[model samples]
Target: MFRTWMRFFTPGAVHHRLGLVCLGVGLQHGAVPAVGPRVLDGYVAVVISSGRGWYRTPDGRRTAVTAPALVWLTPGVPHHYGPDPDTGWDEGFVTFTGPDTATYTELGYIEPERPVVPLADASGPRDVIARIARAARQGNPLLEVETGAAVHELLVALRRARADLAPDGDPVLHALARDACTGMTVADHAARHGMTPAELRAAVRRVAGCSPKDYLIGIRLGRAQELLATTELSVAAVARRVGYDDPAYFSRLFTRRVGAAPVRFRAQQSRAVPDDWNEGLQEDAEPGPPVAEPVDGP
Candidate 1:
């Protein structure tokens, strides 16, 4: 008599805008019986983390579902599935739908024709389903968006599992990318990851198709852009926040790469004007050395 836990969500305008929304998530284990041979209104992805089961499709086709496998319960499709009553099984599921789901179906990402997908590695989908369940329980203001993003990640994991794609990139380089805002030099970061600078650079280039310095700089610039657009932080503060100790140096680099001074960039973003801010500027425009500020910039 194992208890089942389930949560349902009502999506809002934001969820609709994202073109995807999670409707519900649930978990069940031990002595679970068969469920209806009826049609459902929304898409459901059921993953069996343990034990075994059987799934029947609308066309009376049957398939044995083993551990670490997934069964897609497509919208408006008649299906029946359940765990072995004697052995039972641990199950986790997320129900979701969106306008983009049709596109995904058409692209063969979500194959209603092939409902049972054997997963070589089920951990990713399991984790995502747990995340969706947790978000549903917490009922946060951004639950829809958060769960929607998780659903997208879940789909990606499923596709990777189906394609047998191993995780790409070095773990050390991935950690460095995540901690790029720490302001450490490339050599220091490499030492921390127990790799030489050259090794780190090669690994980054192999996986990210960029040098370590360029990858780190991209991460920092992305964060800086977010801070500039969303917050009222001063230029120096934003620079420091993204690991740049010198605001002047940061401004010069940003101008060279992003084609705008930080202050002018912030002003343009705040105003939301569509003027040709870079009009008359040479295609190969290169700024002088790092300066605190530039006149007529952006």
Candidate 2:
């Protein structure tokens, strides 16, 4: 026997801009039918908290699905899956669509190539699923935003729960971020970690969705932004501080990437921060420039 509660939604364009929009969510119990060897227009994340099943892609590759596993049903991709009839199953799912799906895919948070993912523990992901289920109530004015936000959280939870990840997360990322501001070349950084440049590139791409070069530059520029906003360092000094000795080169790169010259950016940002900013700050009110549309990422 099967028991279920489900919700579906059609959000306005405004809600879609939240980057990820929840289209539907539901729970399933008991025997389940095999889904299509057909494609979908959007994406679905099916979480199996218990029981067993099987999933396959259009290419005819099949994977056995087990409890506490997740199956990724991506847009326009044919997927076939269902629970074992004899044992039945327990499942929860969310259907979502958004422009950020591509970004999430690049970041390795959503893996369409591997349709089925075994989890170290589904408890965390299930907790978030329960929250989304609660917001499923009809007449819930905040449903779109609430569930949309949860979609983001759900992705992170799913990533953390991946059976292949280290219990403490990726240590290389921490080491890289810690040393990023040192202005090391890709090869230099790779050597420090005993990885060839090609190997380093692949590892960083698999995890951070960017080349090692881009990640280091991002960190350096971010630190530059902080120093520019809070301190009165000269352009040359600021350049050197973030590991760029050539201030002219640094200024050009910063302007190109950040959309403003160093001096102008500092002036714009520092004026916004009152000297006694600690006293002037409100708990949840740090306003900034208008939100920019999403851009291409590494």
How close is every model to the real structure, measured as TM-score? Answer: 0.56, 0.84
Q: Give, for candidate 1, the lowest lDDT window spanning 10 residues.
A: 289-298
10 residues in a row with least lDDT, candidate 2: 289-298
lDDT on C-alpha atoms for all candidate structures: 0.77, 0.83
Error of 1 at 93 (Å): 0.5
lDDT for each residue of candidate 2 in 103-122, tens digit (9 for 90 to 100): 99989999988889999988
- Model 2 C-alpha lDDT versus the unseen true structure: 0.83
Residue pairs clashing in model 2 are none
Q: What is the C-alpha RMSD of each candidate to the true structure, in Å?
A: 12.1, 7.5
Q: Candidate 1's residue-wise lDDT over 153-236, tens digit each?
A: 888777666533345635776787787877567877777878788877776654455677887888888878867866666787
- Candidate 2, which segments miss by more than 4 Å at Cα? 271-298
